[model samples]
Target: MYADEICRMMVWSRGTAPATHDDAEHGSDPLTREWLVTNGLGGYASGTISGAVTRRFHGLLISALPAPLGRTMMLSDLSIRVVTPDGKVYQVGGQEPWLDETSAEVIDLAEFRLEAGLPVWRYEGAGMVFERRLLLPHGQNTVHVTYTLLEGAGPVRIELQPWVNFRPHEGALDRPVAGPYALTVVEDRYELASPSDLPPLRLQVQGARAEFRIESDRLRNVRYRIEQSRGYDAVGEFYSPGRFSLELPVSGSVTLVASTEAWETINALSTEEVQRAERKRRTRLLLAAAPEVRSGPPAELIFGADQFLITPAGRVEDAARARAGGDEVRTVIAGYHWFTDWGRDTMISLEGLTLVTGRHTEAGYILRTFAHYVKHGLIPNMFPEGKNDGLYHTADATLWFFHALDRYLTYTGDRETLRFILPTLTDIVEHHTRGTRFGIGVDPKDGLVRQGEEGYQLTWMDAKVGDYVVTPRRGKAVEINALWYNALRLMERWVRESEGDAASQRHGAAADRAKASFNQRFWSEEKGYLYDLIDGEQGTDDAFRPNQIFSISLPNPVLDPARWKGIVDQVKERLWTPVGLRSLAPGHPDYKPKYFGDLRARDLAYHQGTVWGWLMGPFVDAWLKVYPADLAGARSLLAGFPPHLDEACAGSISEIFDAEPPFTPRGCVAQAWSVAEVLRAYARTARSAG
Candidate 1:
């Protein structure tokens, strides 16, 4: 049954065609459909299935370096060429220019699919077949690419040319770096060291004898079409130190190991051992999930969920501190191709990524870890890559922290962790009550939490371009107030449990006042739904957004119970899409159908009408709350994700999709909260179905 489900999750395609415009939205185009693998320490490898470098982030090794260095793109790419016994040359994987229609398809790629989150490709031509597989072992700054001659002529020579780069993962590809890249070879092991302060990148081959030829060359203007579309410097350059040539016999295989780790660490496991260990680890992860979600799309999402739960290796002190405390630092990488640990994303993703997956210890670790960073009642909005401290700019992340703690306790019953962070949690609530940074505080008269400040986008609808704050949901945003009310109630319950009734009464009273004010002030009597924001910069925003869903979706419903159906039904009619709920309703003046074009253009549409995949979690939660008997209907709402996993970042959910038809996936390819919410919702509905 597991094998059958694995086969089902596998997305495959035949032929070697350049990506068409439509292919970018769908998974059919190998050049646009990307795949990713991570090493648990924030290090990752990602590239398109067609093997072309479409984005600056497309690489074989993006090593997560210690403080100040962040994620460095060490090994950029590898050009693979196979020489047949008949002297026929074929390019299997290389820097193929996407726009070059004239480029010949030397390697006939017969198949490409992700086998249990590991990418596999098959090439067949002239009665010859070869298979390629790629994976990164857990918690190691390493990547292994193995090739096997499944059915090929004996003694066929294969050449490997590795491209080297010394830049941040988000660095401008076209920017030139001073590089006297010196190559040192000890037997088959090769190390490419640049003049930069960073460490050298190590490369080697296993299960095969290799010959190295010192042919130094620079490939210029390696165009990244995706970057160009996003209005950035698109062209890049790579330095190839040399080529490694090896001979492959029928049914013979060889593996290439690339890393920035020490030689001892690299040599700790053989290529097959690493592969076997990773496969077994993945299986164990799936088994750890709830029984109902151990197969099908949920099982595949369980794999996606693991990609974001990474150690903050860049913050070396965080690790040491955690170790000293007898705990490990675990945080969620909000999204791939470029996102660090975000407070909002992490808290939102906690239940689905950890609790449902049965990673209770890590869940506690995450909660406690964030608790260490709370400032003046606010959690850091995001920890910039390689930075020791996080930026405390968010208004609701801290509130979400309370909800995450509630979910963790509900799942594991680990009161010790609760007791440990309860003080910080109390401080957070007090801070919110009195008022904190970014003008965040509860209203004296109404008790509704209101947050807004100039030059800073506080809420989750935050999308800032230059001086402009898009969707600056300033005063008493629906979701923020809802989360605030929920947090107060949760605190009331926790305080009563730990410190007795007297301490808990304040929280209970505040929650009641907030709930009353929210129901009376925010609801649109004519529209029969909650307003997005009350007492905003302009006035009360009656813009029909999916944010109102949180009014009912949260653990504590802030909106009146009688109005739950009205809000849910309104969201269903206006904001809900197959993929997720749109940021804004279609008829709204700010509604933008598609999230595309340059940075400013995309950000404009970002919260205006873009469909956020993470919102699905809350939508589904609210759906089940409003329609408890229709578990099948809630399960069906998740049906879009299985097909979604096959596209964009294979085996993962994208950060956001287009609000319009086809809902072209935009923003980060693999999102943490996106995968988490979907997985959480799936598990809930599946259990209810049973």
Candidate 2:
């Protein structure tokens, strides 16, 4: 969608400036305020709004290991000191937190907000305004920090310090680079090439005479409280290559472009130019998805969604292999900070992130990218992290693929893309009916999909540690059966829409049998809600959970309207929250309200009662279908998210929230489906409103 066209479609979605959190105005905590900017290659630069590198993931240049796999944190931080005309020195942001306990209290920034997708800062004091801007251009492993004294009392002197390191995001820096580490000192720029195989790190302050101290200093015991809370390494030391001192005249701007690419490409374009381009890209996104939404989606949600979709630039191994299959894989990284693209997440997020957003090209590319990975009538549960082979432990990621495809076909009307994957889709039906991975196959007793095993965690409720399967819903899971029924019906329509189908008669029959069996087996008159799982090892675990909502939410629902009212009321009364649905109801014994502690403890609560933001999409879908007129109530559910953007990741949604009151946000700071679903629901409401 072009910007002009987007403007026409988007009744709102106007401002390009990021929502602001000005310390001078509001005085928020330094550690609590964080910002994120990603290069479309799956690499990102993130830190707090106060400019302190709090998390190990906080870095200026965390390069995508190759393209989109194992990510490595290259540049740790930049320590900036500003000098006024009167020689008054001020910290650009905050220094290492433990350097001085009082430093955070003293460090005060003027203003901070996101401009387009980039992070921009303004230091307003001493009768002057010094602006700092960060831009991570799409598809490039580069970080650009442009400093311009927007308004100054007089000529000011600025001294820049860069704390650089090369470590895996999970690991922390140990010591300074060996003396033998390659260093190229020049008049305008300085480059550090570590002894390790990591990319060469370079810093170029364009239009300034670079002066480096060339001292290898260690800043130790920098505390990462967020990591510490998660039972991970919370403190580490960073090796400062050196500190550079330079002067900027009043109204003069100089950009420090750091990249893995050659020094020339780093300065190829101006940050303002990059900023303009990014804003246009964002505008198109809002506009393209405008038709999906009513007054268009909020700028925060629209911009937040842009962070997940990236070019499928995976780790490339050999030149021959690269040539055989180009690294031009377009995909949506499941979440920021830790998640890679998972099959289930990718399919569930497709329509909202791509089709609804008017990224038809990206949508088609993503579908085809997954299409290439289908095996034995199964799509991978997740593309192996940092590896080529994909895991196929999941029983439903393949089935969800059909619904995603059907959605794409409806939105795009792209016959060629659908035709290409038709055989793969048909093969999935055959494979599921017969048998596939785990114990997943159609049960002859009911014709409903039944899946389970000793250790395999097949459904999204999957949270395993060693041999312990957390939610081991190892039977006729309600949602999986719902998806299976939906898939069968989808295949029937897929055949009818694409090819005048004689070979696909089984789809309709299969759908009918699954629906009848689903209603018979899943329905519970005693409970007044559908069973969470039927015929499991434990024999019909009729727990109240949000999972059964999907059965009534899908386009071709297996549940009748009478059943829909019961399920809807049950979910609303037991599981529903403002942001999302709780994994388990409060009445359930296993339900844990808070998500915290070590891995095992956290896993126990992961699905037990955590409120999932993504589940809101299905909840909204089910609500609208059941009521068909409570648009106000449906809209109110999503209205809670706009404020959520201001709280956690700043204009993005968290993967999950605590089930208890004040429901603290947790998990991936920026989640794909969380953002996608809200946008989709907003659009659905907007269309209804219009």
Candidate 3:
């Protein structure tokens, strides 16, 4: 997911098809679709089932109503039953169900029923109604749905219906097509359509609402039309594949009918099918392992409205929906709620967004935006929404910003832009020298920077609860010092090329001084590891942490080869997980595995022992930096990344993972940093292989 404050629509096509108006109207067709159906407008969809039981699958599901306007309706009644190709009947799973602000609550929803022989489940609701049957032959199965709406609304209109199409691409799967049709709003109307003719699309309307006769006809190729009474507004469009145009009256209600043609098609494709397809394609190219590595299948998930995207700046609306909703075709076009002046996301999102998918412009924006925050020697932790507020929690975001800037310069070679930010970079170093938030002041004795104790999180694993610091190192963190060392080196290098001999000499001396002091103070021979942090008293914590990864992995190296190898081995044995690099080692007294539950339990596990996606960047980099450059070894090390990239999520990536075994992808499913890190790692590996 590319992280940038500004977002725009991107369209890509193969061959020269002579750019035509048809692309604008229908968005370049056979009308492929990838729908990310969630119950709510914002939050993530839930698909987890705890404990075992039977009855029917019941939950609050949400899909965009098949209308012209882009509006969604709640699926209050959702029940499904499963039966194998054999004669055995599988128990349905739906218990006490309730719709909350962002998810469905199912109480005892998975009880095993004693009765057998082709089980079926019935679903009834106020606005919409349906029934699902289970246990049919394996190859193809028919699904039936009955729909009805309330009275006194207006004419009912259905437009651009869904259809299935085939793709000729090597790995292309079946695709859903959005037909061009329109519906009128009306009261008490019956509508129906089907993928096959085995059973006539069934419709029954009987209630207190006004009733209208229905006229249904198959017209113009595969298109179908249903017209009812006229009164309410009728608006809708089939946006692409998985999306439909839908609009509803402020006061009226509408019933939706849903069924798929093939069971395999249903299982193969999701509302986010297009986005998933794109993810598979990109992951294949990015994964260092096989040419065929793909994400896992789409998991059936649903979310509600009222959820918001959480960022350092503040919560923003539908920031990740494009990716979650399956609209992410290229670089998961993810948005942030706020982009503080320091541009926290800008630099951080680069590895995931640009390098992974090769979206460099997005990378540039991240650097430029944060450079905007370098005011008076401070690169803001974030830029507050609709204000000039710049929060400075991170002592190294600015330093990392310089590293990213250097990278951007290497990629684009825009020396003018590089020169433009040089002054700001100098200001940031100067500010750290003076002093800032927490107690991030310079230590004159050793020349190593001293960061004070603060409540806010600075580095990526920053977790704080109320007044207690979760993983506070107090004085100076290992990674921050590593970044500081890199920053000085970057400045020295930049000064030589852009500012000539005198500037380089001045910065070079400072870099040497800082480098010597950093090595002397942070290296720990007794522990055979770098100290996690150094406080005002210069006390060191020898805990196994990920912070030291940067001391060896980053582009600029401050640690000797022996120390780098030791740190890498220690981290690998302690914090490494298949899903990601853990925030802290499991053996730490504070480590906890249960990451889901109430706020405190979750937060306690957050940075204490959780695995983070972004940390994979430094881990991979450090591993390669320390090991002898064996192409086979590097490829073998990177092989684990592809499955996570292609599994079920399609083009999107998760935020964090469980620190322990079965490291289920948890936290946000489509995090900016995760995408950025994956992209950067993929690019690094790909370039090496090339």
lDDT of each structure?
0.85, 0.75, 0.45
lDDT value, candidate 2, whole model: 0.75
lDDT of 3 at 131: 26
Which pairs clash in model 1? none
Two-way lDDT contest, 1 vs 3, winner: 1
Model 3 local distance difference test score = 0.45
- Put down candidate 2 lDDT per residue, 555-667, tens digits, no spaces: 88988678888888878888888888899999789999988776888898999999999999989999899778878888887866866765657667889988976777777
Candidate 2 residue spans exceeding 4 A from truth: 1-28, 67-69, 95-107, 172-180, 292-297, 315-328, 498-501
Off by over 4 Å in 1: 1-5, 8-17, 21-27, 93-105
Candidate 3 wrongly placed segments (more than 4 Å): 1-342, 383-390, 536-538, 645-651
Q: How would the candidate models be sorted by TM-score, starting from the highest?
A: 1, 2, 3
Candidate that scores best on lDDT? 1
Per-residue error (Å), model 3, residue 624: 1.4
Decreasing lDDT order of the candidates: 1, 2, 3
Best by TM-score: 1
Q: Residues 412-462, candidate 3, lDDT per residue (tens digit)?
A: 787877776788887777778777666776777776776756575666556
- What TM-score would you give candidate 2 relative to the actual structure? 0.91
